[model samples]
Target: MVDADWKPSMGFIYGELRKATQEIKGALNDNENAYKPILDVIKEKSSKRLDTCLHMAAYILNPYYYYYDPLAKLDVEADDSIVEILGVLFPGDYELQNQIKMVELPMYKNKLEKFDRPIAIKACAVNNEKFDPANWWDSYGGSAPNLKRIAIRILSLTTSSSGCEIIWSIFEGVSNFKS
Candidate 1:
């Protein structure tokens, strides 16, 4: 689920620890206090790294959340948050800021307007269909090139290196067996 190519799947990591802790607490019922310290540690660590700017931007760019799901409510401060990240990443780039104001923001607004339409509604309702958000951006990139660039960059990031560690462990196991 940490795969960079799967844009919609990337959001699964963002509150994962909190969700898991809540679920365990629910299951444990009266025993929750016994695990409070562990839960607190998980919450603390998750909060420290969970919602970085790239992750938030990826959520906004994900079609399943932003464009297709009418019930999905984006944070009200999303625009300002994205702008702040862009400012940090591209400081002193007046042209880029102008493009964000003139080009990207309008495109995002238009997409928001389209969210309640039949197409988006159907896309959201269909569970079996596999929609590639990157492909969608590829097809529509020409329409909003600057926004598309931002989406591509954010969505392409892997939130963690656990997958690489897993691969390394498997390789080590195989090498030890051979030795």
Candidate 2:
């Protein structure tokens, strides 16, 4: 589970999941029979859980991938997903709709020019490792309020329930010890 107070961005979680899957596959090359089931389960569950509007929105909104990573491709589907999530999150905001029409729609339509200005320039100067993206969104809230809200909500989510399971395990251990 994600921490109540803090969490890694969805982009980071997605990257980690992809890397872990690749590593697992690589390590089980000859022992495919023993690990294939595990791999299949991981792939199935991850595809279902991670392929959501919120995750896509968080991934697109992360500046490290948005401006620095060549692998971050923003397609129409991603735009639609972000828009859908935003609409759900902010149903009554007319300014959000206008912003999408005037800024985001044009940016998506002209992908080549999406990173041409202020964002690209600023993103290049920042050290991604040290930078807290949540804080960045907080600062950019005035300039890109809708996107900032989307980023904050989506990025705060944990990709898996492993954290909760770990906590449960610890609780069980303590309960058994007490008993």
Candidate 3:
């Protein structure tokens, strides 16, 4: 995260975090009795430290995880509260939110309009490793303008405020020079 080029988008964070947790759990003791106790502790601690609406929203907005994660089923119902963040984002704009939820979201999820085009359909299948999901909105999401904006914003956001660290370092250098 300290390196801008290497910083993952906020949208990918929770899914990757989940994958990491799953890997650890799967690699632990085979006996459920033994591992269950440790797994519960791990879950408790990790959820307290890491779970947030931001993470859930990011996971939902990014199609790579939302539509096609191999590790786990994308449970939209489980992330309902995070989905409501979109409502809060526009604050009192029920019509727009309704359009997003009722119309735009479904189209994108179902791969209609430009999203159904050959180039877009091939995104997840052929060139998935090279295709950036954030850019998908810009290229093939014109029909769902509202979701396109939300997706891009969430998917493009850096996982950390590492730019602040650079500024802090510069300040420290200045302070040392003064001393």
Candidate 4:
């Protein structure tokens, strides 16, 4: 989830968690007796790390998963995450929150009005090789300005600054070599 090239989004956090859960379960199934303790530890650590409202908000806002994902909902409560994010975006503004939840959010969620346009619909194509969730919001989210702002801001965040650190280390190595 910490790719530094602007490719990783918070939505991938939940996706990774789900993938790991499935893989661990499947791999452990063959040797349940031997791996039960190990599997339990993995599950505990993963849940502690991956369980967060941020993950839920990202998963819910990312149109790829929110719109097309057929799997059951994540363990977090959707309402709680949405409320928490909205609160952060508009603290002490209950009216705005309600409006977003009632009007703007639903428009995006249901693909209403401009969201239903062919271009917008095509933008949410998760199967596309170059699909960037933030870009999708930037392109098609104009209809819901408030929700659009938060979606773009949140989705644009890099999962990690490690990429920058790696680049800096590489630069340091090159500089030292020159010295």
| The candidate that achieves the highest TM-score relative to the unseen native structure | 4
Cα lDDT of model 2 by residue, 69-159, tens digit? 5445644565567678757866888687768657754453333343345764474346455555565556544445555566666665555
Question: What TM-score do all the candidates reach, one by one?
Answer: 0.59, 0.58, 0.71, 0.73
Prediction 1 global C-alpha lDDT: 0.60
The per-residue C-alpha lDDT of model 1 at residue 127 equals: 26
Backbone clash count for every predicted candidate, in the order shown: 0, 0, 0, 0
lDDT tens per residue, model 3, 1-179: 21346534676666777766677667874567666777687678658434566667767666677567654245654257445777678889888888888898778767788778877776644323455667776788899998888877776776555666788999999889953
Give candidate 2's error at residue 127 in angstroms: 7.6
TM-score of 1: 0.59
Q: Say which candidate scores most in lDDT.
A: 4
lDDT of 3: 0.68
Q: Point out the higher-scoring one by lDDT: 1 or 2.
A: 2
Could you give the candidate ranking by lDDT, starting with the highest?
Answer: 4, 3, 2, 1
Q: What are the runs in model 2 whose C-alpha is more than 4 Å off?
A: 1-7, 19-40, 74-76, 92-95, 101-129, 157-179
Better of 1 and 2 by TM-score: 1
Better of 2 and 3 by TM-score: 3
Deviating ranges (above 4 Å) for candidate 4: 4-6, 23-39, 72-76, 127-129, 161-179
Model 2 global lDDT (CA atoms, 0 to 1): 0.60
Give the higher-lDDT candidate: 2 or 4. 4
